[model samples]
Target: MQIRKAFRYKLMPKGEHIRKMKQFCGYARFIFNRALAYQKAQYESDNTVKFSYTRLANLLPEWKHEFE
Candidate 1:
């Protein structure tokens, strides 16, 4: 007998389910971006770009929870 080192996936979903999934995905993306913006505002405001390392590291865990 031989062993196989491969895997297959089946992501088949109903039409309605797909549509709903798209909507949820869009909403989730929007929320994620908005949260990032708000998080940035705490340290920067002018809407200009700047390095924000500490802020990002501090918020990483909270962001993960939001996604979960």
Candidate 2:
């Protein structure tokens, strides 16, 4: 027999914390959308293209530089 346990906690962010949290969420959403769009474009351009995480990660620096 085995036993497993899980824990969950609720956040009660205030003022500045709330603002920072929202900012981080926005950045995460942006990165995800960009990655999805890249993958999609690659697929559309090349039917035999394979998904590569490394390729996406390698592009991050370029993206940051481009956007900044």
Candidate 3:
């Protein structure tokens, strides 16, 4: 038999950390929404379309250049 323990800690970020965290969160949301919209379009255009992680992974570099 084995025993396991889990812990959760609350975070209190400083000003600069808070700012960076917000920026990251915003960027993540933007990317997620963009990917979701694209998937939706593909589905609307053709019901047989498959969802792909590689497809979105390929878009990351282009998105970075555009957003940055």
Where does candidate 2 stray beyond 4 Å? Answer: 1-8
How many steric overlaps are in each model, in order?
Answer: 0, 0, 0
- On lDDT, the leading prediction is 2
Question: Would you list the rank order by TM-score, best first?
Answer: 2, 3, 1
Error at 26, model 1, angstroms? 0.8
Give a tens-digit lDDT track for model 3, residues 1-68.
99999999999999999999999999889999999998999999999998999998998999889887
lDDT of each: 0.75, 0.97, 0.94
TM-score of each: 0.50, 0.84, 0.81
Q: Which stretches of candidate 1 lie over 4 Å from their true place?
A: 1-7, 45-68
Question: Model 1, 2-24: lDDT tens per residue?
Answer: 98798889999999999999999
**lDDT score, candidate 2:** 0.97
- The 10-residue segment of model 2 with minimum total lDDT is 47-56
All candidates in order of lDDT, best leading = 2, 3, 1
8-56 per-residue lDDT for model 2 (tens digits): 9999999999999999999999999999999999999999999989999
Q: Which residue pairs in candidate 1 collide?
A: none
